[model samples]
Target chain A: MTTPASSTADNHAWLRRQARWSPYELAFWLAVLIPFWVFPTYLTLASQIAITALFAVSVDLVLGYAGIVTLGHAMFFGLGAYAAGLLTKAGWGEPLSGLVLSGLLTALVGLLVSFMIVRVQHLALLMITLGLGLLTAELANSLGWLTGGTDGLQGVDVWPVFNHFEFDLWGYTAYAYALAALFVGVAAARRIVHSSFGLSLRGVRENLNRMPAIGSPWRRHLQIVYTISAGMAGIAGAVLTHTTETVSLDSLSFQRSADVVVMLILGGTGRLYGAILGAAIFMIARDQLSDMNPQYWYFWIGLLLMLVVLFMPKGILGGLSGLLRRLGG
Target chain B: MSEIMLATQSVRKSFGSLEVARDVSIELPRGARHALIGPNGAGKTTLINLITGQLAPDGGRILLEGVDITHAPVAARVRRGLTRTFQINTLFPDLTPLESVVMAICEREGKAAQFWRPLTSHGDAIDEAHEILARLRLADEATRTTRHLPYGKQRLLEIALALATKPKVLLLDEPAAGVPKDESAMLFSVIDALPEDMTILFIEHDMSIVFTFASRIIVLVAGGVLLEADPDTVRSDPRVREVYLGSAHGH
Candidate 1:
């Protein structure tokens, strides 16, 4: 908190600070939350939105902030799901223990894979991560003993909240829990982005030459952010498994990985709300389109993505922001 | 110790088959304003790269306060109080001058790159950035993006960024290059007013600007130091006259 102003004049000055949030952030969130609670179907959709938002947020932390482009983020997500699934199967089914263990297991895998991925940049990073995601799917397929292979590791029963409250399928406890968790994750990420370290990464992105001139080890900073983002992605994946007690090979698939990136771009690249906005649009479109035709649904999405990539290169929210810029100018 | 804050001794660097900076040396004492003048392919910039730790010397040593920093990485060299401006103006194109300076000062203060606390919360850093801009006569341009500024102003912003590093020594690679002819004095005044604690080594093709500012001049001809002399000797030397001014203006 800021030091309380010594005089009335100083207090007034603080009130006028530019960083103070405007009514837009307040009103926009109010609108989003009302819908989630109003519709019965929105509860399930909202929880999925929260999970996918967290996952996409993790990807953006790396892509937008850290400048590591990848399409294989599902590798971390899948690792997290398997971790939660397998721990429950092993009878460590308590909510707190299962959640903590799942995050830890996913984090461990992330640590091992990060050193290799962080060394490459641009398209090479993209290609390597794609390979890594595909390889993870194949490994999940072969590890039938642990993951139940193609059939999946089923019968995961997430132990009750604090060993007391039970999970319901309808619009109740699960959605709220995910929303609370998402708020914490997003708040922490927001804090991290405004820190001195985040400025250094922006400097790195601007010019690799400038970092050393300004006293920053570019590679080391990149590694640290990548590692953190991977762990966060892993935790998001684990949360999905906890909410829905199933882990399958599809979790590790490249298609899931690509979908998350598309969601990230759909919202906005670097904007904080981009991930949440992206995930919401992606899930709603998928749901609406699937109802129309299960097999042909993806074709419409492909068309939408093409139009957005060409005309709205900055993504949806970004395009809106650009519109504001032109009007202001 | 000759009051030299930075010294490059017989440093040599090259790219592939081209030996760009061959056995070059210079000493920048505290408060010394030195100018480097050379023809188009004279290797002045290659030598500047060696001093700034962007290029490791193929041979010889570089010392900051007599301690060898020949192999120090660029970041380490910067923390040791060295800063440089690029030949081509480089700024965060979209960021206003105030934001750019805030970033530089933050780096010097060891702030993490982007901690999510709002940028306005960095009162001290922001104030220092504003002060630097005002000192450089850039106060009016604080809110304007560097890329949108006039060419001469962009050059000053580059120097402002270097100044933000609070360097003990500054290396400027052609600060006046490509600046609009009419805007030359605006850039010159900014460079002229730099604090004396900052040892300056600037490369310039324009003799008028070089002679206008520098106390001492070092002439590089064809990838090596040809002569180090006071302005009087450098101006009168037949060799410098033949090599540089003669080539450019045909005597």
Candidate 2:
């Protein structure tokens, strides 16, 4: 009995230690800020990376943590972009409010869609999400008068952030705004994944059959995480619309959804930092490779993916952590 | 007489032509230790599933503490103080035993929806989970990933998880399945030490463990109960011997 008390305390301490941020995580966030100073000319690309990284993190919340395999995540992202773009176009162009409202709206839709998404599993779930994504893209295309279709939603007028910092051509404000959003999104996600709800999601991912017997309803947990993930993705899309002042039809396309998945796979799934790292690497590689050879960039990208998969199946971050463990031991 | 903790009245289930449960009826009083003994293909696991809401019965009622809960979901049943362990190991392989049990405790406490706070903040749940692990003699293995644990320890972890729910009625479908013979006896000793007020109904193929731990023996044959009586009576009953114990001992 004496041993039980000490052992229980040890378990509690161990869990707290695991939840604490490591030095590497702090260093990663600090490094993210360095681009604003050092890469002044490349701020536009840097902001794009930040927005995409945020999107990747949102995808990881569902696909990695909750074990939801969805191909329609970009539907919510696209919806948020359109929501923010249309709001600014119509006269309500408050940047912060627009972002919040867009995220909440997408969350509402996500909650509704999750009812259907949580009902199925495996291939059926994938098909439903993919079908919904295609349907949204087609609907946007058909409603050209409202959405501007392939010409894109032009004349999106976003006022200066906080009425103080205008979005400059140099992309200083854009990079700062996107970076702030990324930090907030990552911090919130980190909190969620280390919580009981997050642990339950992992349990659902690991063995869904065993959840109910332990008194946890699997569907409810999945639905909550899915809705939250959607909301985060929506916020990322809203950031893009605010920074770019345009909403293209490609924003809601299946390609965007697939690209986020690719980013998550490249960085590793389940871990939040992996998503951000993957996004940064993929976008950087694309920027440099496309500049070098415009028409054949895909060939290089494909080769890089193959190399990563063959050599580091768990993704670069996972591989690095494994190496670090072996070295430390 | 003690109050009935669990009862199934004329429950029926079938997989097309295969009758897994045919008008099956059984009862467990408070604190009763009952062993369900039967030959292979006797539908013991299926009966456990029917009670736990994994598979809906074709007809009849399932009552817990005199409340009919035949149509309740598995989670609802667990919340109502009824829990069960699987014949095969079903666990979170990547998670440590401590994390898994704490998550189970959080679910039991209705705190699983708390996402804003870190898991360590649930101090009560963590302590409770650790207590459960220690009670099951898994304290040393608590921090190891479940997939890396030995087969016997993994089986024990299953029972530990079930206990975290604080169930009043526990149904164990071969809780010691696939464990070594020596470990199986240790497993039963743990089961024997559970709260006296808790009801238990277990399905076991090993007669020696069954006769030692079970105050009463229930012989199920072909989706129906052939005999239900005290172990002394059950051991002497020719029908029980012919259908179950006879073959079990022969092997």
Candidate 3:
């Protein structure tokens, strides 16, 4: 029914649009399509990437956009994991409701913590956040009865997503679920950073002293963003708990906090897509290198991170963009 | 009857016996085009900071519209319509002038909390931002990030930001400090054209600029008021002449 000439022209236009894709957009599509083209065995790896990216992006919301450096973001993640686990144990194993309930509960804790968090800046803020994360980890460890005492939360059960897709052993459903949540999280963060409130946050980041004269309560703004960011992190934690059907003390560990921060910086901070790119690269590298040499994989990661900091302070996406610019676009 | 737009009563401040303000009191009525003149380090900026609630006074009351705001926070004071600029230009280095003005306008209108909508969707804020940039003759540079602007333009943008808030009491600390004399004229002309009811208190080192913009001038020496009088009287007062104008003429 279509003319040959018109069809050829349409094909040409489509090719042009494809050629014009930003590296981040290209990467996003590739990530979304991993299950179709990648080995079926790597599907769980894809799920891990998606969940870790969600966590990294939430950290970016605070560190990258709001300029609040934190090493305690894992506290929110752990709170969410525990909340989802407890909900499932109580016979309410609905995935969507679990995600929301955990997110809100983590947000409430984040809001309370932010009062103290926003009062400090720079090194003090960093130290306080780190301390808070460690304290939560210790609490989970000591209160084993509630959190399974370092053995991890036992017997967490997740219902099939919407009663349609069973969580297969090959992780097709889990990967899909995590990717969808990541997509929604990225979309929401994009909306926030492009809003008027987001502009004011950057203003506060650039110059805190000038904010008062412009009639902005910068502390209040920082607090609100921190709470929202923590909630986003909570969603990531809930996703991991539901997919694996287990919650562990590692969820609250400082190492988890540090690793995500590293991943965020590796992919670049401030921009949302950096979270996805960084998480994929970090998790995949860890998986492969650890399989190759289980004892020294961290050495390689540390080396890679050093190289990134030294040569590309802006991270992977930022470096790529700069390269593209210098090469005359 | 004209009422006091801003007043400070016997405010005292000291940094470990290095007194910056010693029992300084001022009553600036509405529409008063006043200037605070002093030699360097006489605490002209400190007084502005005190009135704007940046630094708490050790002793005294600051009242805005006869309501005491001595204990108010900086944001609260700005919301009550008191705002100031700095001797050194302070602006969001990453934001464009249009974005900067839009943010100020939004914050003033209590729209800074709306996080769901795109900033460009606020048609009223965007329109008002454009109008303000045009008034300040910064329309051409509206989209340029403020860090890349010339010093004179940055200074103008600082005033533009303060103006966007529709402040009842606008305090500009050395608004023309880094600007060339020729451009400073242009800057003052813009300030000159603002509504007459907006009480303005500016600190300036240029005697010509001060005499032209301010109806009354208050001179300070060594952290204390030397004289507060109409321009002509302050210009001729021997005490002011010995303390400030002497140094001015000597230069």
* Least well predicted 10-residue stretch by lDDT in candidate 2 chain B: B242-251
List pairs with backbone clashes in candidate 3. Answer: A144-A149
Model 3: per-residue lDDT, tens digit, A1-329? 11121222333332233224367676766658757466778889989989999999999989988899999999999989999998999999999999999999999999999999999989999999999999999999999888998789999888889977877898888888998999899889878887888888888888888899888988888999999999999999999998999999999989999999999889999888887789989999999999999999999889999999999998988898779768874
DockQ (Cα-based) per candidate? Answer: 0.42, 0.63, 0.32
Report the alpha-carbon TM-score of model 3 versus the true structure.
Answer: 0.93
Q: What share of the true interface contacts does candidate 3 keep?
A: 0.61
lDDT of each: 0.79, 0.92, 0.87
Candidate 1, residues B1-251, lDDT tens digits: the string is: 45889888888877888888888888888988899988888888878888888777899999997889999888788888888989987777755676677778887776644555566567777777767877777777776656678877778888888888888888999998798655765677778888877788898877887888999999998889999999999999999989898886721
Error of 1 at A66 (Å): 2.2
lDDT of 3: 0.87
- What is the per-candidate TM-score for chain B? 0.95, 0.98, 0.97
TM-score of chain B of 1: 0.95
Stretches > 4 Å off in candidate 1 = A1-19, A35-37, A96-101, A108-112, A162-164, A325-329, B113-121
DockQ of 3: 0.32
Instruction: Estimate, for each residue in B1-251, the C-alpha lDDT of model 2 and write its tens digit.
Output: 98999999999999999998988889999999999989988899999999999999999899999999999999999999999999999999999999999999999999998889899899999888888998899998888888988999999999999999999999999998988889999999999999999999999988889999999988889999898999999988888878786677654
